[model samples]
Target: MKYLLNSNNNILNKLKTKNTLLAFDLDGTLSPLVDDPSNAYIPDTTKCLLAKINKFKKYKVAIITGRSIASTKKILGELPLTIIGNHGLESFYAKIEEKEKWKKRCLILSSNLKDIFDQNEFFIENKKYSVSVHFIKKNRSNSTIKKLANTIKPLLVKNEAIILGKNVVNILPSNKSNKGFALKQIMKKYNLHQALFVGDDNTDESIFEIKKKDIIKIKIGMSRNSSATFYLKNQKEINSLLKLLNDVQTQGINFLCMNMD
Candidate 1:
C-alpha cells in the first residue's frame, strides 16, 4: 500500500533468489515505441535473455500488454512463456488454447467498433493492433483531448466500449482490461513470491502502485515521481538489465550445484 522508489539494481537483488517471475511490457520497454506498434519487436539481446530465462523451470516469464493474444504471438514469433493481452482481459499460457480463443472472441465487438470509428474519420494513431486516438501530437493540450473525448464518449458508450485515457485516448470493449489486473492474475497463476515489472508508460503506473514488497516496480525511460522503484534511459539499459539477470541466474545455479556436490 505504501509507495517506495528504489535504485536501478535494487530489483535485481530480489531476482537473485530462484523462482522469480519477470513480467514485461511490450512496447517502449522490451521493444522501442515506433509510429506503428504492430511492427515493433524486442531487440535480439532482450529476446535472447528471455529464451535463457525460459530454460529454468523454476522461473517464469510473462508478457503483459494491450495487444491481442494472437497479435502478441504474431509479433513475438515464438511464444514459450505465458502472455496476458488486451490489458488483462485475455490470458494465455503455453499449454492452453481454449482460453485464448474465448478471449479473442470476446473482443470481436471491438473490431466492429474499430470499423465504425474508421468510417467516421477519427484519426486512429496507435494501431499496433491496439488502437488509440492520439491528441498528443496536436499540441498535448487538455482542450484537444477534452474535445476528442466529448465527441467519442457517447459513441463508445453506446457500443459498450470504454475509454482508457493514457498519453492518448483509447476506446475498447468494456472488459476488465488493465495491467494491474493482469499482473495480479499472472502472479496468482505462477504463485509468484517475488516478481519484477518493467515498463515505460503512464499506464504501467497502475501495476506499480499495487506491488508488494517482493514485487518491485521499474521504469524505463523518463523518470518522474512515479510508483516505479527505479528508472533507466532507454532500451539499451533494459537489455543490460536482462543480461544481468541471466548472468545472476547462471552463477547462482552453478554455486548451488557445487555446494551440493
Candidate 2:
C-alpha cells in the first residue's frame, strides 16, 4: 500500500470535481482509540482542516461510525458534515420507531449476555441500536479472550449481528444497515461521483466491500490483509493526510479560478 501523502497528487488529479464525498470513521480513523471511548476527541489541527474542507461547496464530508448519533454529535460538537451513527442504524433518515425497536432488542441481549460474562471482566457500551463489548481494560490473555469469544458465539446466533474490532466485539441488530450501506446512501443522496473513505477496524471492512473504481479506501494501520487500497502508519498520520487533502482542494479551487479567468 502506498503512503497517502505520497499519493496525494495522484489522488487529487483524479478527484478534481466538487462531486466528491469524504467519509471517515470516528474512533480509530479521526480520533485515536482510547481505553474509554468517551475520552476520544479530534485533534485541533484536524478539526481546523476539516472546517476548511467543509468551506468548499463542491465537497461534502461525513462521519460514519459505530457510535450512536447523539454521542457522535456530542464528541465532535458542531461540525458542518453529515453523520451516520450506530453503524448506519441511527442516521438522519432512520425512523424513530425503528431505532427504538433496535434499542430495545440490544438491551435485551445485553441483559442476557451479562449473565454469562462477568460485568467486571468486560465493559459493555449500550448505544442506540447496538452494544459494544470492550475487553481492553480486562487485560486477558489471548487464549482467554479466544475462549471467551467461543463461549459467547453461540449466544448471539439469533437476531443479533456481531462485528469484531480491536479488543472489542460489537453486537448490532440483524438488519441490512451497515457502514457500506450508509456510504452508498449518502453518495446517492448527494449525487456524488466518487468518495474517499478512511477507517481502521473490522467494522470499516463493510465500506471496503464497495467495488467502485472511483472510491479511495484507506486503512489507518499497516495490515497486509486489509481490504483497503492504501494504508497509513498510524493515527498521527491522519493529520498529515487531512492537511494534504486541504492543500489539494485549495489548489483545485485556485486552478479552477485561473481557468475561469
Please tell me which predicted candidate would have the highest TM-score against the true structure: 2
Candidate 2 lDDT, 24-89, residue by residue in tens: 999988888887887889888778878888887767999999998888888788786899988898
TM-score of 1: 0.74
lDDT of each: 0.63, 0.79
Poorest 10 consecutive residues by lDDT, candidate 2 = 252-261
Please provide, for model 1 over 144-242, each residue's C-alpha lDDT reduced to its tens digit, 9 standing for 90 to 100.
Answer: 666766766665433334344433566544434568777877777778777888887666887888848777677876565577766665655776666
**Each model's number of backbone clashes?**
1, 0
Q: lDDT: which candidate is best?
A: 2
What stretches of model 2 exceed 4 Å from their correct place? 7-9, 138-147, 157-159, 252-261
Q: What TM-score would every model get versus the actual structure? A: 0.74, 0.89
